[model samples]
Target: MIYADDSGHPASGLVLYGWIEFSPDHWAPVLKSWLDLRKRLWRDYGIPVTQELHATQFVNGRGRISQRIPPRFIHRGVEYWKDFGREVAVQCLETLRSTEGLTVGAVWRRRSPAELAQTKSEAYSALIRRFEDELAEADSLALVFMDGDGSDSSYRKSHRSLKLAQRRVIEDAIHLDSRSSQLIQMADLVAWCANSSVDRHPGNHFASEWYSTFLAERDPCRSPREI
Candidate 1:
């Protein structure tokens, strides 16, 4: 199974779509590890286990989404919280690295300010094609679960239009709300970090090397494939 998510704007230097692949045999342990991490995050950081870990918001200290910041911080002090948020994001990425039985993959396409509106659609389509090729080479089949509650016609069209002789991707992506799906949240983190490695957000101090720092070991490809 695959859990996917996307990050970056078409007008940005690159638009990224990425996924974490897991086999049936390792699914149980993968879920177990994430749940365990959530439990620890809640116990140690006052972060609610049920909270959706949106990487960008969480890193920049925007949402105050944590159920409560630990009392020691003196009313969630701005400078302190800002730095703490980066710590939490790093820890989350570390969890992804320590967990086994998952492989990360992403495809990104660069677009300039004048690019068409469909740039992201084209990049996502490229990702689907890569997934199909990987599955075919392995002689396996897989299902894609992406972060969203509503249907995406563009993604649906990508799968429907695949040119492979034997389509190994089951169908159009099975959409899931990231709020309720731990794996999709992880995918969100993966895509966000991967994009940051390529295009540093002005305010994101940790963006420059996070993909290389935390996720490189788990991702044999080491970096996103630029299409």
Candidate 2:
């Protein structure tokens, strides 16, 4: 099932992560149509990148709404950020929807920790629990995608505890039927794109908090190469 999430961090406050879900078979066409419209909006308005087009700035003259992205954009954005996860949900959804035989399901993530003692791994466990609770009805395949910590030494060190927590959660969850469950690290792909600025405008800023928390959750002891 397709799942997505976003992160946000404003100043000194704790990091926040948001998530949402979609039924891929049911929503794929709708999402594709919406993305087509987004592309056209960019083409029509000369907006080269998704990030440059702010949700508030997109307008629909036919609908007579000002400062509102088209209904589809609004709908998808709202769905993706149902719990404040961040923009990565959008990216993740877009990527997964492109494949066949995939369906999206409930999305979730831990937002912030009141104490530094709460590791990133622990926060991830909370996220997984939320997902499990939400999707208890179906025994469908589940794939979790998280943006990894960036390539900064200090940030990596800061995230050590969180990383350990994530590892623990994976270990705990691994006992489930291996054929039905899989966990992947999409951080490398994310990091490569972000660092290279391939899609800089649509970079992780839309879900900055998720990105920051990812940084804060790094396995401090692991090298960037290892991550």
Candidate 3:
């Protein structure tokens, strides 16, 4: 199955879509490793192992990030979130690099204000083609799990638009609550860091190297595609 997520916004000049793929035989072991990472996060920050690690919110110091470790306690500054966010996110991603059964892929594109919607559509379609090619090469079928509750029609259409004889994604995307799925949350991290690699920002300058540093080893693209 593939656990997918996206980052960036229409207001931003760059947007990204990312997913982590693994086979059914390895699913249990893969999930165990992911949960193991959450355990480590809980140990380090006193954050609940089950808490949704929404990359944007978690990094911005929003939500109950931890119980014993206060976000502000990490640093005494208005931007403590950004500082500690870089630290925790980097640690988690580096750890994820060793997850045994996953392959990563992502595609991003830069767009002007007027072109954001159209460019996003094109980029996602390009990623869908990549997914199709991979499944075809392996002669396998896979389900796509995205971070939402099945409300996104664009993704459904992307899968459905594939030539009927050629489409490999099983039915429509199976959306789930990201809060309950650690895999999807990791995909969220993938998306965010992929965006930072291209669209550098003052707030997330610390993530500038995260994509090349952590995720590149697993992605055949080496760097994410610039569609």
Query: What TM-score fits each model?
Result: 0.92, 0.36, 0.90
Q: C-alpha displacement of 199 in model 1, angstroms?
A: 0.5
Give lDDT per model, in order. 0.81, 0.32, 0.80
Over 131-216, each residue of candidate 2 has an lDDT whose tens digit, in order, gives 45444545443444343333223223333334443332222221222112122212222232222121223433443333223322
Residue-level lDDT of model 3, residues 56-167, one tens digit each, is 8777666557676645656555446555655677777876689887878778887886887777677777778877887899899988898888776777788888888888
RMSD of every candidate to native, in Å, equals 2.0, 15.0, 2.4
Could you tell me the TM-score of candidate 3? 0.90
Give the TM-score (vs. native) of candidate 1: 0.92
In each prediction, how many residue pairs overlap at the backbone (N, C-alpha, C within less than 3 A)? 0, 19, 0
**How well does candidate 1 score on lDDT at residue 16?**
83
After superposing candidate 1 on the true structure, give the runs of residues whose Cα lies further than 4 Å from its correct spot: 75-79, 114-116, 163-165
- Name the lDDT value of residue 194 in candidate 1: 82
The digit string of per-residue lDDT tens for model 1 on 23-77 reads 9899999989889989988988878888999887888777575666766555545
Clashing pairs in model 1, backbone N/Cα/C closer than 3 A: none
lDDT sort, best first: 1, 3, 2
What local lDDT does model 3 show for residue 66? 69
